[model samples]
Target: MSLSIKQQLIAQLDRILSAKLEALAASITSTQESRDSDTKSSAGDKFETSREMAQIELNNLENQAEKTARMLNELKQIKTTSTATIGYGSIVNTNHGTYFLSIPYGKLQLDGTTYYVISMASPIGQ
Candidate 1:
């Protein structure tokens, strides 16, 4: 049998989330390198401020990476074969548009079809 719309959407989401995780990790790495390189310079208030900002940026990137990883894990756990109802894993066709029930991940287009990936808790989804 062919893959369901839910399955196609899940595959697309996985690709998107994995790309985000990669970008975030690369950013974190670059930030750390910058922070470390700054330490070789002479000590001064400006140097301190630069290091502080880099640290904050690194921390933020790390946090975002963690969240993205968590989201990826959650997405993997979702079964894409279910379309019995307008709930999680459900790919619904409404008059206005199509919706893939899950996290509020914004718009996605696959195979000439547009889908709004949304969470059940959202007003539009509810």
Candidate 2:
């Protein structure tokens, strides 16, 4: 069956988030491998610096993965059906643009129409 605009938007978000999570996982894995393979050379300071850098990168990637996972969970909770009041998962149409109150991902274009996917916490969403 054909999906509504909201459903389509949710699907798109899922795809985006899933891809981001995968990429982050790959990055984390690569960083861990690099750090593990790092050998202590004559220059101990250089080796320590490399390990520290890798750890920092891994930490950042892990944090991003956690955030993306939370966003995916949020998207899964969204109901695509129309709502009487504007809130999360509501699709708003205005003269300026169409907005989907789902995540912070911005500027979605579908079927020749533009949609601004915004989080309620954002200034514009407020």
Candidate 3:
């Protein structure tokens, strides 16, 4: 593949990460608002339950946001220039399939060819 292919892949991953982070932030904000508004009504048990659920959801969303941010950082660190060896930012084309050693984004299609974007820490990547 050419440098442009890697650049395009990086751009796609960046967009995906940004959109995910944005959605997670929105969800976290909404959950926080809902939890804050859950005042102690006449039914204290119900209020507590609602608040707890919101808190759990907020925690999950926050975790996802952090992970997405990390992915964005990793993507930013990728160099589009070709490498002589199979390593980070390397694009490997085999008889079985093509692989992009970056983040674990599963499968991505570019110019009719499907590429697997995988992290170095992943089983296949290792």
Candidate 4:
């Protein structure tokens, strides 16, 4: 049995998300180290400025991590098999067009046939 297009997409997204999350984690760690070092050497205005910058960076990383996590959850919720409704992860086929539920990437093979990869937000996908 071949993996569905949706499954392939989810796998790709998962890989991307995991790498992103790892990078974010590394950023958080580096930020923490900088904050610690600045606090030890600086005082008054300089210390406050460094602290604020670090906090802002941390917040941004947190927000991005949250957004990525939500996207992953949404992908996980997508139904693999549907009669013909277009939704996230739906390999849609219509009289007017055909689309695979995938990230905007190159050709993908499923069951020995090539599919045009398209993200859920693509013009043809919507």
Candidate 5:
């Protein structure tokens, strides 16, 4: 069966979100490895610095992952079949506005025109 535009958008968003989650998981794993090495080497100040840096990186990744997850969840929450209205997974067009109904991944070309990729929850999308 052919998928609707909304379904296509959701699939795209899911792909992006899965990659993001994998990256975050990898970061956490690396951080844990570094912490373990620091403990084994007893590097003192250097160890502490590395640990702090890893912690900071992990925190940043967590924040970004959370935001992406929320976007994905919001997309899943939307339930509409009309392409006439702009909602999650619904590409929208206006006289001066063009937006994709998924995560903002920058600019995309559709029908030979550049449309700004935007998350459905973004102000531009709203």
Candidate 6:
């Protein structure tokens, strides 16, 4: 069956988030590997610095992946069939542009359509 605009948007968002999560996971894996491979060299503090940096990178990537996964879950819970009123899962169209009132994410392009996906709690959404 054909999907509605909302469903399509959610699908696009999901794809983006999933890809982001995958990239983050790969980065974390690489960072951890580098950290594990790091050894104390004649540079004294260089090994420690590299290990610390690798841990920081791994932490940041894991955090970002968690956030992306959370957003994906949120998209999955959204009901596509809704009203014109501005609220969560609502598509608000203005004289200037179109908006998908859900997440705080800014602009997204899909099939030649440009949609500003903003949070309902944002000032623009309000």
Which candidate number would show the highest lDDT if scored against the true structure? 3
lDDT of 6 by residue, 1-126 (tens): 123888899888988888888888888888888899988999978888888988888888888888888888888878877654556788877898998877877899978989999887888888
Q: What is candidate 2's CA lDDT for residue 23?
A: 94
Q: What C-alpha RMSD separates each model from the true structure? A: 2.2, 2.1, 1.0, 4.6, 3.7, 2.4
Q: Quote the positional error of residue 41 for candidate 6 in Å.
A: 1.7
Q: Candidate 2: minimum summed lDDT over ten consecutive residues — where? A: 1-10
Whole-model Cα lDDT of every candidate shown, in order: 0.82, 0.88, 0.89, 0.69, 0.67, 0.82
TM-score of model number 3: 0.95
Report the lDDT tens digits of candidate 2 across residue range 1-126: 123878888988899899999999999999999999999999999999999999998999999999999999999999877667889888888888888888888898888988999999987787
Against the hidden reference, what TM-scores do the models get?
A: 0.87, 0.93, 0.95, 0.67, 0.70, 0.89
CA lDDT of 6 in candidate 3? 94
Which candidate gets the maximum TM-score versus the true structure?
A: 3
Sorting all predicted structures by TM-score, with the top scorer first, yields: 3, 2, 6, 1, 5, 4
TM-score of 2: 0.93
- Pairwise lDDT winner, candidates 5 and 6: 6
Tell me which residue pairs clash in candidate 6: none
lDDT of 3 by residue, 54-85 (tens): 99889889999998999899999998877677
lDDT of 5 by residue, 44-119 (tens): 7876787788778878877887877776677677654565554665666678776666666667544465657686
Candidate closer to the true structure by lDDT (higher is better), 3 or 5: 3
**How many pairs collide in each candidate, listed in order?**
0, 0, 0, 0, 0, 0
Give the runs in model 6 whose Cα sits over 4 Å from its true position: 1-3
lDDT winner between 4 and 6, please give it: 6
Colliding residue pairs in candidate 3:
none
Model 1 clash tally? 0
Name the 10 consecutive residues with the lowest summed lDDT in model 4. Answer: 1-10
- Which rank order by lDDT, best down to worst? 3, 2, 6, 1, 4, 5
